[model samples]
Target: MTEPANIPSDALTTDVLIRHRREIVDLKQRIKNRRLQVLGLYGTPIVILAALITWAGLKVFVWLHSNTPDAIDNITGFVVFFSGVTFAVQAVAEFSKELSTRRDRKTPVRELKLELSLAEERHVLEARRRTPPPMDRQASYKERLPGEIARLRKESRHYRRIHLFMQWMLFINSAAISAVTAWYDPPQPAKGVLICLGFIVTLITAAAGYFKPRERAFNLQLTADSIEQNATALELGISPYDAVEEKRNLALFATTVEDLRAEQRMREQQLDQPQQGQQGQQEVI
Candidate 1:
Protein backbone atom coordinates (compact mmCIF):
# COMPACT_ATOMS: atom_id res chain seq x y z
CA MET A 1 0.00 0.00 0.00
CA THR A 2 1.75 3.19 -1.20
CA GLU A 3 1.11 6.32 0.87
CA PRO A 4 -0.38 9.30 -0.95
CA ALA A 5 1.95 12.29 -1.27
CA ASN A 6 1.43 14.82 1.50
CA ILE A 7 0.65 18.33 0.42
CA PRO A 8 2.77 21.20 1.76
CA SER A 9 1.24 23.13 4.66
CA ASP A 10 2.20 26.44 3.00
CA ALA A 11 0.28 25.52 -0.17
CA LEU A 12 -2.75 24.49 1.89
CA THR A 13 -2.66 27.75 3.85
CA THR A 14 -2.40 29.78 0.64
CA ASP A 15 -5.37 27.95 -0.82
CA VAL A 16 -7.45 28.57 2.32
CA LEU A 17 -6.53 32.25 2.35
CA ILE A 18 -7.48 32.62 -1.31
CA ARG A 19 -10.89 31.06 -0.68
CA HIS A 20 -11.44 33.18 2.45
CA ARG A 21 -10.50 36.33 0.54
CA ARG A 22 -13.07 35.49 -2.17
CA GLU A 23 -15.76 35.07 0.51
CA ILE A 24 -14.85 38.45 1.98
CA VAL A 25 -15.13 40.05 -1.47
CA ASP A 26 -18.58 38.48 -1.97
CA LEU A 27 -19.74 39.75 1.42
CA LYS A 28 -18.56 43.28 0.60
CA GLN A 29 -20.42 43.22 -2.73
CA ARG A 30 -23.60 41.99 -1.02
CA ILE A 31 -23.39 44.80 1.51
CA LYS A 32 -22.95 47.36 -1.26
CA ASN A 33 -25.94 46.01 -3.20
CA ARG A 34 -28.13 46.04 -0.08
CA ARG A 35 -27.21 49.66 0.69
CA LEU A 36 -27.96 50.67 -2.90
CA GLN A 37 -31.36 48.97 -2.65
CA VAL A 38 -32.15 50.93 0.52
CA LEU A 39 -31.07 54.17 -1.12
CA GLY A 40 -33.25 53.57 -4.19
CA LEU A 41 -36.25 52.60 -2.07
CA TYR A 42 -36.14 55.85 -0.11
CA GLY A 43 -34.87 58.07 -2.91
CA THR A 44 -37.61 57.25 -5.43
CA PRO A 45 -40.32 58.91 -3.29
CA ILE A 46 -38.28 62.09 -2.84
CA VAL A 47 -37.67 62.30 -6.61
CA ILE A 48 -41.37 61.80 -7.27
CA LEU A 49 -42.25 64.50 -4.73
CA ALA A 50 -39.87 66.95 -6.37
CA ALA A 51 -41.31 66.29 -9.81
CA LEU A 52 -44.88 66.72 -8.50
CA ILE A 53 -43.99 70.00 -6.79
CA THR A 54 -42.43 71.30 -10.00
CA TRP A 55 -45.56 70.35 -11.96
CA ALA A 56 -47.76 72.11 -9.40
CA GLY A 57 -45.62 75.24 -9.64
CA LEU A 58 -45.94 75.28 -13.44
CA LYS A 59 -49.72 74.83 -13.12
CA VAL A 60 -49.93 77.72 -10.67
CA PHE A 61 -47.96 79.93 -13.08
CA VAL A 62 -50.40 79.04 -15.89
CA TRP A 63 -53.37 79.65 -13.60
CA LEU A 64 -52.09 83.13 -12.72
CA HIS A 65 -52.00 84.02 -16.45
CA SER A 66 -55.43 82.48 -17.26
CA ASN A 67 -58.75 84.44 -17.52
CA THR A 68 -60.69 82.03 -15.24
CA PRO A 69 -58.25 82.34 -12.34
CA ASP A 70 -60.75 81.21 -9.66
CA ALA A 71 -61.70 78.01 -11.49
CA ILE A 72 -58.02 77.29 -12.18
CA ASP A 73 -57.24 77.95 -8.53
CA ASN A 74 -59.82 75.36 -7.47
CA ILE A 75 -58.35 72.78 -9.86
CA THR A 76 -54.75 73.58 -8.78
CA GLY A 77 -55.71 73.31 -5.10
CA PHE A 78 -57.17 69.84 -5.64
CA VAL A 79 -54.15 68.70 -7.64
CA VAL A 80 -51.71 70.01 -5.02
CA PHE A 81 -53.70 68.44 -2.18
CA PHE A 82 -53.85 65.05 -3.88
CA SER A 83 -50.16 65.19 -4.80
CA GLY A 84 -49.12 65.97 -1.22
CA VAL A 85 -51.29 63.18 0.19
CA THR A 86 -49.96 60.70 -2.37
CA PHE A 87 -46.36 61.65 -1.57
CA ALA A 88 -46.93 61.22 2.16
CA VAL A 89 -48.53 57.81 1.64
CA GLN A 90 -45.72 56.66 -0.62
CA ALA A 91 -43.07 57.91 1.84
CA VAL A 92 -44.73 56.06 4.73
CA ALA A 93 -45.08 52.89 2.70
CA GLU A 94 -41.39 52.94 1.73
CA PHE A 95 -40.35 53.51 5.34
CA SER A 96 -42.48 50.64 6.55
CA LYS A 97 -41.17 48.34 3.85
CA GLU A 98 -37.58 49.20 4.81
CA LEU A 99 -38.33 48.49 8.43
CA SER A 100 -39.94 45.17 7.61
CA THR A 101 -37.01 44.22 5.39
CA ARG A 102 -34.59 44.97 8.21
CA ARG A 103 -36.59 42.79 10.57
CA ASP A 104 -36.88 39.90 8.12
CA ARG A 105 -33.33 39.83 6.79
CA LYS A 106 -31.31 37.03 8.35
CA THR A 107 -28.01 38.95 8.01
CA PRO A 108 -28.42 42.70 7.90
CA VAL A 109 -25.78 45.09 6.55
CA ARG A 110 -24.18 45.63 9.94
CA GLU A 111 -23.86 41.90 10.57
CA LEU A 112 -22.42 41.37 7.11
CA LYS A 113 -19.86 44.08 7.71
CA LEU A 114 -18.94 42.47 11.02
CA GLU A 115 -18.57 39.13 9.28
CA LEU A 116 -16.37 40.70 6.63
CA SER A 117 -14.19 42.29 9.27
CA LEU A 118 -13.77 38.97 11.07
CA ALA A 119 -12.94 37.19 7.84
CA GLU A 120 -10.30 39.81 7.01
CA GLU A 121 -8.73 39.39 10.43
CA ARG A 122 -8.68 35.61 10.03
CA HIS A 123 -7.06 35.96 6.60
CA VAL A 124 -4.39 38.16 8.08
CA LEU A 125 -3.75 35.66 10.86
CA GLU A 126 -3.49 32.76 8.46
CA ALA A 127 -1.16 34.70 6.15
CA ARG A 128 1.05 35.59 9.09
CA ARG A 129 1.40 31.94 10.11
CA ARG A 130 2.93 30.80 6.84
CA THR A 131 6.50 31.94 6.14
CA PRO A 132 7.12 31.91 2.41
CA PRO A 133 10.61 31.57 0.94
CA PRO A 134 12.31 34.75 -0.28
CA MET A 135 11.75 33.90 -3.93
CA ASP A 136 8.12 33.03 -3.31
CA ARG A 137 7.61 36.31 -1.47
CA GLN A 138 9.14 38.21 -4.37
CA ALA A 139 6.91 36.36 -6.83
CA SER A 140 3.82 37.11 -4.74
CA TYR A 141 4.67 40.82 -4.56
CA LYS A 142 5.29 40.91 -8.29
CA GLU A 143 1.94 39.28 -8.96
CA ARG A 144 0.18 41.99 -6.89
CA LEU A 145 1.82 44.76 -8.91
CA PRO A 146 -0.60 44.28 -11.81
CA GLY A 147 -3.61 44.75 -9.51
CA GLU A 148 -2.13 47.94 -8.09
CA ILE A 149 -1.43 49.26 -11.56
CA ALA A 150 -5.00 48.53 -12.60
CA ARG A 151 -6.44 50.30 -9.55
CA LEU A 152 -4.37 53.41 -10.17
CA ARG A 153 -5.37 53.50 -13.82
CA LYS A 154 -9.03 53.07 -12.92
CA GLU A 155 -8.90 56.02 -10.49
CA SER A 156 -7.12 58.09 -13.12
CA ARG A 157 -9.85 57.36 -15.62
CA HIS A 158 -12.57 58.23 -13.09
CA TYR A 159 -11.06 61.62 -12.29
CA ARG A 160 -10.49 62.37 -15.96
CA ARG A 161 -14.14 61.63 -16.72
CA ILE A 162 -15.36 63.86 -13.88
CA HIS A 163 -13.15 66.70 -15.07
CA LEU A 164 -14.51 66.40 -18.58
CA PHE A 165 -18.12 66.34 -17.37
CA MET A 166 -17.68 69.48 -15.27
CA GLN A 167 -16.05 71.31 -18.16
CA TRP A 168 -18.89 70.38 -20.49
CA MET A 169 -21.50 71.52 -17.94
CA LEU A 170 -19.81 74.89 -17.62
CA PHE A 171 -19.68 75.33 -21.40
CA ILE A 172 -23.31 74.31 -21.93
CA ASN A 173 -24.62 76.54 -19.12
CA SER A 174 -22.71 79.54 -20.45
CA ALA A 175 -23.95 78.98 -24.00
CA ALA A 176 -27.56 78.54 -22.84
CA ILE A 177 -27.48 81.76 -20.81
CA SER A 178 -25.99 83.66 -23.72
CA ALA A 179 -28.52 82.34 -26.25
CA VAL A 180 -31.52 83.02 -23.95
CA THR A 181 -30.45 86.56 -23.10
CA ALA A 182 -29.67 87.44 -26.74
CA TRP A 183 -32.77 86.02 -28.46
CA TYR A 184 -35.58 85.53 -25.91
CA ASP A 185 -37.34 87.82 -23.40
CA PRO A 186 -37.84 85.82 -20.20
CA PRO A 187 -39.93 86.85 -17.14
CA GLN A 188 -38.13 88.60 -14.27
CA PRO A 189 -38.26 85.47 -12.09
CA ALA A 190 -37.00 83.32 -14.94
CA LYS A 191 -34.17 85.76 -15.58
CA GLY A 192 -33.24 85.66 -11.91
CA VAL A 193 -33.19 81.84 -12.00
CA LEU A 194 -30.94 81.91 -15.06
CA ILE A 195 -28.59 84.30 -13.26
CA CYS A 196 -28.53 81.93 -10.30
CA LEU A 197 -27.63 79.08 -12.61
CA GLY A 198 -24.80 81.18 -14.02
CA PHE A 199 -23.54 81.78 -10.51
CA ILE A 200 -23.74 78.04 -9.87
CA VAL A 201 -21.69 77.41 -13.02
CA THR A 202 -19.09 79.92 -11.80
CA LEU A 203 -18.94 78.10 -8.48
CA ILE A 204 -18.57 74.79 -10.24
CA THR A 205 -15.68 76.15 -12.29
CA ALA A 206 -13.98 77.46 -9.13
CA ALA A 207 -14.44 74.11 -7.43
CA ALA A 208 -12.98 72.23 -10.38
CA GLY A 209 -10.00 74.57 -10.44
CA TYR A 210 -9.43 74.18 -6.72
CA PHE A 211 -9.73 70.38 -6.74
CA LYS A 212 -7.64 69.98 -9.95
CA PRO A 213 -9.10 66.64 -10.99
CA ARG A 214 -7.35 66.83 -14.36
CA GLU A 215 -3.98 67.21 -12.63
CA ARG A 216 -4.79 64.38 -10.26
CA ALA A 217 -5.64 62.09 -13.16
CA PHE A 218 -2.42 63.00 -14.90
CA ASN A 219 -0.32 62.28 -11.82
CA LEU A 220 -1.99 58.93 -11.19
CA GLN A 221 -1.52 57.84 -14.79
CA LEU A 222 2.12 58.88 -14.73
CA THR A 223 2.76 56.91 -11.56
CA ALA A 224 1.02 53.83 -12.89
CA ASP A 225 3.01 54.01 -16.13
CA SER A 226 6.32 54.35 -14.27
CA ILE A 227 5.55 51.33 -12.10
CA GLU A 228 4.54 49.27 -15.13
CA GLN A 229 7.72 50.19 -17.00
CA ASN A 230 9.88 49.10 -14.05
CA ALA A 231 7.90 45.89 -13.59
CA THR A 232 8.24 44.96 -17.25
CA ALA A 233 11.97 45.64 -17.19
CA LEU A 234 12.38 43.52 -14.06
CA GLU A 235 10.40 40.61 -15.52
CA LEU A 236 12.31 40.62 -18.82
CA GLY A 237 15.67 40.82 -16.97
CA ILE A 238 16.64 43.89 -18.95
CA SER A 239 18.52 47.12 -18.15
CA PRO A 240 18.71 47.52 -14.34
CA TYR A 241 17.98 43.85 -13.55
CA ASP A 242 20.18 42.45 -16.31
CA ALA A 243 23.50 42.91 -14.50
CA VAL A 244 22.34 41.56 -11.13
CA GLU A 245 22.11 37.94 -9.90
CA GLU A 246 18.65 36.31 -9.68
CA LYS A 247 18.01 36.78 -5.91
CA ARG A 248 19.65 40.20 -5.84
CA ASN A 249 17.65 41.23 -8.86
CA LEU A 250 14.41 40.23 -7.16
CA ALA A 251 15.37 42.14 -4.00
CA LEU A 252 16.29 45.22 -6.00
CA PHE A 253 13.06 44.99 -8.00
CA ALA A 254 11.03 44.82 -4.78
CA THR A 255 12.85 47.82 -3.30
CA THR A 256 12.43 49.83 -6.48
CA VAL A 257 8.73 49.05 -6.66
CA GLU A 258 8.22 50.05 -3.00
CA ASP A 259 10.11 53.31 -3.53
CA LEU A 260 7.91 54.13 -6.51
CA ARG A 261 4.78 53.54 -4.41
CA ALA A 262 6.15 55.75 -1.60
CA GLU A 263 6.90 58.52 -4.07
CA GLN A 264 3.39 58.24 -5.48
CA ARG A 265 1.98 58.60 -1.95
CA MET A 266 4.09 61.68 -1.37
CA ARG A 267 2.86 63.20 -4.61
CA GLU A 268 -0.74 62.51 -3.59
CA GLN A 269 -0.20 64.19 -0.22
CA GLN A 270 1.35 67.22 -1.89
CA LEU A 271 -1.56 67.44 -4.30
CA ASP A 272 -4.04 67.28 -1.40
CA GLN A 273 -2.50 70.28 0.38
CA PRO A 274 -3.94 73.77 -0.14
CA GLN A 275 -2.02 76.27 -2.25
CA GLN A 276 -1.21 78.39 0.81
CA GLY A 277 0.09 75.38 2.71
CA GLN A 278 2.21 74.28 -0.22
CA GLN A 279 3.67 77.79 -0.58
CA GLY A 280 4.46 77.91 3.15
CA GLN A 281 6.15 74.52 2.97
CA GLN A 282 8.17 75.64 -0.04
CA GLU A 283 9.24 78.80 1.78
CA VAL A 284 10.34 76.77 4.79
CA ILE A 285 12.30 74.39 2.58
Candidate 2:
Protein backbone atom coordinates (compact mmCIF):
# COMPACT_ATOMS: atom_id res chain seq x y z
CA MET A 1 0.00 0.00 0.00
CA THR A 2 1.17 3.52 -0.75
CA GLU A 3 2.16 5.46 2.39
CA PRO A 4 -0.30 8.20 3.19
CA ALA A 5 1.06 11.65 2.37
CA ASN A 6 2.20 13.80 5.31
CA ILE A 7 -0.49 16.32 6.14
CA PRO A 8 0.15 19.27 8.41
CA SER A 9 -1.50 18.77 11.83
CA ASP A 10 -4.22 21.29 11.30
CA ALA A 11 -5.80 20.97 7.88
CA LEU A 12 -7.83 24.14 8.35
CA THR A 13 -4.89 26.39 9.09
CA THR A 14 -2.74 27.97 6.43
CA ASP A 15 1.02 27.53 6.51
CA VAL A 16 3.00 30.30 8.14
CA LEU A 17 5.46 31.42 5.48
CA ILE A 18 8.99 31.04 6.86
CA ARG A 19 11.81 30.30 4.44
CA HIS A 20 12.60 33.70 2.95
CA ARG A 21 12.81 36.23 5.74
CA ARG A 22 15.65 37.94 3.96
CA GLU A 23 13.50 38.52 0.91
CA ILE A 24 10.76 40.04 3.05
CA VAL A 25 13.25 42.46 4.56
CA ASP A 26 14.63 43.26 1.15
CA LEU A 27 11.17 43.83 -0.27
CA LYS A 28 10.33 46.28 2.54
CA GLN A 29 13.55 48.13 1.85
CA ARG A 30 12.70 48.27 -1.83
CA ILE A 31 9.37 49.88 -0.97
CA LYS A 32 11.07 52.49 1.18
CA ASN A 33 13.54 53.13 -1.64
CA ARG A 34 10.72 53.51 -4.14
CA ARG A 35 9.01 56.08 -1.94
CA LEU A 36 12.25 57.98 -1.72
CA GLN A 37 12.47 57.82 -5.48
CA VAL A 38 9.06 59.44 -5.79
CA LEU A 39 10.14 62.12 -3.35
CA GLY A 40 13.33 62.73 -5.36
CA LEU A 41 11.34 63.06 -8.55
CA TYR A 42 9.37 65.85 -6.94
CA GLY A 43 12.60 67.44 -5.67
CA THR A 44 13.75 68.36 -9.20
CA PRO A 45 11.96 71.70 -9.04
CA ILE A 46 13.81 72.55 -5.83
CA VAL A 47 17.09 72.50 -7.77
CA ILE A 48 15.80 75.16 -10.15
CA LEU A 49 14.61 77.24 -7.23
CA ALA A 50 18.03 77.07 -5.58
CA ALA A 51 19.81 78.04 -8.80
CA LEU A 52 17.43 80.96 -9.36
CA ILE A 53 17.87 82.17 -5.79
CA THR A 54 21.64 81.98 -6.12
CA TRP A 55 21.56 83.97 -9.36
CA ALA A 56 19.36 86.62 -7.70
CA GLY A 57 21.70 86.85 -4.72
CA LEU A 58 24.74 87.22 -6.99
CA LYS A 59 23.05 90.05 -8.91
CA VAL A 60 22.23 91.96 -5.71
CA PHE A 61 25.69 91.41 -4.18
CA VAL A 62 27.53 92.54 -7.34
CA TRP A 63 25.64 95.90 -7.24
CA LEU A 64 27.92 97.01 -4.33
CA HIS A 65 31.12 96.50 -6.40
CA SER A 66 30.26 97.52 -9.99
CA ASN A 67 26.79 99.18 -9.63
CA THR A 68 25.65 97.26 -12.76
CA PRO A 69 22.18 95.64 -12.39
CA ASP A 70 22.60 94.06 -15.84
CA ALA A 71 25.32 91.70 -14.50
CA ILE A 72 22.79 89.80 -12.38
CA ASP A 73 20.44 89.28 -15.35
CA ASN A 74 23.27 87.91 -17.52
CA ILE A 75 24.38 85.46 -14.85
CA THR A 76 20.80 84.38 -14.22
CA GLY A 77 20.22 83.86 -17.96
CA PHE A 78 23.32 81.66 -18.23
CA VAL A 79 22.26 79.62 -15.26
CA VAL A 80 18.78 79.11 -16.70
CA PHE A 81 20.15 78.03 -20.06
CA PHE A 82 22.46 75.40 -18.56
CA SER A 83 19.76 74.17 -16.21
CA GLY A 84 17.31 73.75 -19.09
CA VAL A 85 19.85 71.73 -21.08
CA THR A 86 20.49 69.35 -18.16
CA PHE A 87 16.78 68.70 -17.76
CA ALA A 88 16.40 67.92 -21.46
CA VAL A 89 19.29 65.47 -21.53
CA GLN A 90 18.11 63.71 -18.40
CA ALA A 91 14.59 63.38 -19.81
CA VAL A 92 15.85 61.79 -22.99
CA ALA A 93 17.94 59.26 -21.09
CA GLU A 94 15.05 58.36 -18.80
CA PHE A 95 12.73 57.95 -21.74
CA SER A 96 15.15 55.63 -23.49
CA LYS A 97 15.55 53.45 -20.42
CA GLU A 98 11.80 53.31 -19.91
CA LEU A 99 11.26 52.10 -23.44
CA SER A 100 13.87 49.39 -23.10
CA THR A 101 12.54 48.06 -19.79
CA ARG A 102 9.00 48.03 -21.14
CA ARG A 103 10.02 46.02 -24.16
CA ASP A 104 11.85 43.46 -22.04
CA ARG A 105 8.60 42.22 -20.53
CA LYS A 106 6.37 42.00 -23.58
CA THR A 107 3.60 40.36 -21.65
CA PRO A 108 2.49 42.42 -18.70
CA VAL A 109 3.47 41.07 -15.29
CA ARG A 110 0.51 39.05 -14.05
CA GLU A 111 2.53 36.36 -12.37
CA LEU A 112 2.54 37.75 -8.85
CA LYS A 113 -1.04 38.91 -8.86
CA LEU A 114 -2.36 35.71 -10.36
CA GLU A 115 -0.36 33.45 -8.12
CA LEU A 116 -1.73 35.20 -5.06
CA SER A 117 -5.25 34.85 -6.32
CA LEU A 118 -4.87 31.16 -7.13
CA ALA A 119 -3.36 30.37 -3.78
CA GLU A 120 -6.24 32.04 -1.99
CA GLU A 121 -8.75 30.31 -4.21
CA ARG A 122 -7.24 26.89 -3.63
CA HIS A 123 -7.19 27.47 0.10
CA VAL A 124 -10.87 28.35 0.06
CA LEU A 125 -12.01 25.55 -2.23
CA GLU A 126 -10.20 22.82 -0.36
CA ALA A 127 -12.46 23.65 2.61
CA ARG A 128 -10.38 21.95 5.30
CA ARG A 129 -13.56 21.40 7.28
CA ARG A 130 -14.65 18.87 4.69
CA THR A 131 -11.36 17.01 4.42
CA PRO A 132 -10.72 13.95 6.58
CA PRO A 133 -8.98 14.80 9.85
CA PRO A 134 -5.59 13.29 10.88
CA MET A 135 -4.74 13.47 7.20
CA ASP A 136 -1.86 15.62 5.95
CA ARG A 137 -4.13 17.51 3.64
CA GLN A 138 -2.03 20.66 3.82
CA ALA A 139 1.40 19.05 4.00
CA SER A 140 2.19 19.35 0.31
CA TYR A 141 0.99 22.93 0.27
CA LYS A 142 2.87 23.88 3.45
CA GLU A 143 6.12 22.27 2.35
CA ARG A 144 5.89 24.18 -0.88
CA LEU A 145 5.38 27.67 0.67
CA PRO A 146 8.75 27.95 2.43
CA GLY A 147 10.54 26.90 -0.71
CA GLU A 148 8.63 29.49 -2.67
CA ILE A 149 9.61 32.25 -0.25
CA ALA A 150 13.24 31.09 -0.27
CA ARG A 151 13.30 31.14 -4.03
CA LEU A 152 11.76 34.61 -4.12
CA ARG A 153 14.38 35.87 -1.69
CA LYS A 154 17.07 34.40 -3.89
CA GLU A 155 15.58 36.02 -6.97
CA SER A 156 15.49 39.45 -5.32
CA ARG A 157 19.10 39.34 -4.13
CA HIS A 158 20.36 39.87 -7.69
CA TYR A 159 18.42 43.09 -8.13
CA ARG A 160 19.13 44.26 -4.59
CA ARG A 161 22.87 44.07 -5.12
CA ILE A 162 22.54 46.22 -8.20
CA HIS A 163 20.43 48.69 -6.22
CA LEU A 164 22.79 48.85 -3.25
CA PHE A 165 25.65 49.65 -5.62
CA MET A 166 23.75 52.52 -7.19
CA GLN A 167 22.88 53.98 -3.79
CA TRP A 168 26.54 53.95 -2.84
CA MET A 169 27.28 55.88 -6.01
CA LEU A 170 24.66 58.48 -5.06
CA PHE A 171 26.07 58.87 -1.54
CA ILE A 172 29.53 59.44 -3.01
CA ASN A 173 28.31 61.90 -5.60
CA SER A 174 26.42 63.90 -2.99
CA ALA A 175 29.57 64.24 -0.93
CA ALA A 176 31.61 65.26 -3.96
CA ILE A 177 29.13 67.98 -4.84
CA SER A 178 29.15 69.33 -1.27
CA ALA A 179 32.96 69.43 -1.35
CA VAL A 180 33.08 71.39 -4.61
CA THR A 181 30.56 73.91 -3.29
CA ALA A 182 32.74 74.59 -0.28
CA TRP A 183 36.05 74.91 -2.22
CA TYR A 184 35.12 77.57 -4.76
CA ASP A 185 35.37 81.39 -4.21
CA PRO A 186 32.90 82.67 -6.84
CA PRO A 187 30.81 81.26 -9.71
CA GLN A 188 31.88 77.79 -8.54
CA PRO A 189 31.96 75.84 -11.83
CA ALA A 190 33.21 72.61 -10.22
CA LYS A 191 30.50 72.78 -7.60
CA GLY A 192 27.93 73.61 -10.27
CA VAL A 193 28.87 70.62 -12.39
CA LEU A 194 28.93 68.19 -9.46
CA ILE A 195 25.58 69.39 -8.13
CA CYS A 196 23.97 69.03 -11.54
CA LEU A 197 25.49 65.59 -12.03
CA GLY A 198 24.45 64.47 -8.57
CA PHE A 199 20.87 65.57 -9.14
CA ILE A 200 20.70 63.74 -12.47
CA VAL A 201 22.11 60.52 -11.05
CA THR A 202 19.69 60.66 -8.15
CA LEU A 203 16.79 60.79 -10.60
CA ILE A 204 18.10 57.74 -12.43
CA THR A 205 18.43 55.83 -9.18
CA ALA A 206 14.82 56.63 -8.34
CA ALA A 207 13.47 55.30 -11.61
CA ALA A 208 15.25 51.98 -11.26
CA GLY A 209 14.07 51.78 -7.69
CA TYR A 210 10.43 51.92 -8.72
CA PHE A 211 10.48 48.98 -11.11
CA LYS A 212 13.23 46.55 -10.22
CA PRO A 213 11.77 45.04 -7.04
CA ARG A 214 8.40 44.62 -8.65
CA GLU A 215 10.13 42.45 -11.19
CA ARG A 216 11.47 40.27 -8.39
CA ALA A 217 8.04 39.95 -6.80
CA PHE A 218 6.77 38.78 -10.14
CA ASN A 219 9.65 36.33 -10.27
CA LEU A 220 8.41 34.65 -7.09
CA GLN A 221 4.88 34.32 -8.41
CA LEU A 222 6.20 32.91 -11.66
CA THR A 223 8.06 30.18 -9.79
CA ALA A 224 5.12 29.28 -7.56
CA ASP A 225 2.91 29.00 -10.60
CA SER A 226 5.36 26.72 -12.30
CA ILE A 227 5.43 24.23 -9.43
CA GLU A 228 1.67 24.35 -8.94
CA GLN A 229 0.96 23.88 -12.61
CA ASN A 230 3.35 20.97 -12.78
CA ALA A 231 1.70 19.31 -9.80
CA THR A 232 -1.74 19.86 -11.25
CA ALA A 233 -0.75 18.03 -14.42
CA LEU A 234 0.33 15.03 -12.40
CA GLU A 235 -2.89 14.99 -10.38
CA LEU A 236 -4.89 15.16 -13.58
CA GLY A 237 -3.34 11.90 -14.74
CA ILE A 238 -1.13 13.42 -17.42
CA SER A 239 1.89 11.29 -18.19
CA PRO A 240 5.31 12.30 -16.98
CA TYR A 241 6.48 12.75 -20.55
CA ASP A 242 3.62 15.12 -21.27
CA ALA A 243 4.25 17.24 -18.13
CA VAL A 244 7.89 17.61 -19.05
CA GLU A 245 7.07 18.56 -22.61
CA GLU A 246 4.36 21.00 -21.62
CA LYS A 247 6.47 22.82 -19.02
CA ARG A 248 9.19 23.54 -21.54
CA ASN A 249 7.06 26.20 -23.23
CA LEU A 250 6.09 28.15 -20.11
CA ALA A 251 7.43 31.72 -19.94
CA LEU A 252 8.99 32.51 -16.57
CA PHE A 253 10.08 29.56 -14.41
CA ALA A 254 13.08 27.22 -14.61
CA THR A 255 12.65 24.12 -12.46
CA THR A 256 13.73 20.55 -12.98
CA VAL A 257 10.52 18.93 -14.21
CA GLU A 258 11.83 15.37 -13.67
CA ASP A 259 10.35 14.90 -10.22
CA LEU A 260 6.90 15.68 -11.53
CA ARG A 261 7.43 13.34 -14.43
CA ALA A 262 8.49 10.61 -12.07
CA GLU A 263 5.36 11.12 -10.04
CA GLN A 264 3.16 10.88 -13.11
CA ARG A 265 4.84 7.66 -14.18
CA MET A 266 4.40 6.14 -10.73
CA ARG A 267 0.71 7.01 -10.63
CA GLU A 268 0.09 5.77 -14.16
CA GLN A 269 1.79 2.43 -13.47
CA GLN A 270 -0.33 1.96 -10.36
CA LEU A 271 -3.62 2.67 -12.14
CA ASP A 272 -2.84 0.36 -15.03
CA GLN A 273 -2.70 -2.73 -12.78
CA PRO A 274 -5.28 -5.53 -13.28
CA GLN A 275 -6.15 -5.24 -9.56
CA GLN A 276 -7.74 -8.13 -7.53
CA GLY A 277 -9.74 -9.56 -10.47
CA GLN A 278 -7.42 -12.55 -11.12
CA GLN A 279 -7.26 -13.55 -7.45
CA GLY A 280 -11.06 -13.45 -7.11
CA GLN A 281 -11.46 -15.72 -10.16
CA GLN A 282 -9.00 -18.29 -8.76
CA GLU A 283 -10.79 -18.29 -5.37
CA VAL A 284 -14.15 -18.84 -7.04
CA ILE A 285 -12.85 -21.78 -9.09
- Candidate 1, residue 87: Cα displacement in angstroms equals 20
Model 1 worst lDDT run, 10 consecutive residues: 98-107
Per-residue alpha-carbon lDDT of candidate 1 for residues 83-169, written as tens digits (9 for 90 to 100): 567666544544565544343134467887898899999888877876677987997898899999999999999999999999998
Q: What's the TM-score of each model vs. the native?
A: 0.63, 0.26
RMSD of 1: 8.2
lDDT of 2 at 242: 51
Evaluate model 2: give its TM-score: 0.26
Where is model 2 poorest over a 10-residue stretch in terms of lDDT?
A: 100-109
What lDDT score belongs to each candidate, Candidate 1 first?
A: 0.78, 0.52
Per residue, candidate 2 scores C-alpha lDDT tens digits across 83-130 of 666666544543565543322122222443454455555545555444
| True-structure RMSD, every candidate | 8.2, 23.4
Candidate with maximal TM-score: 1
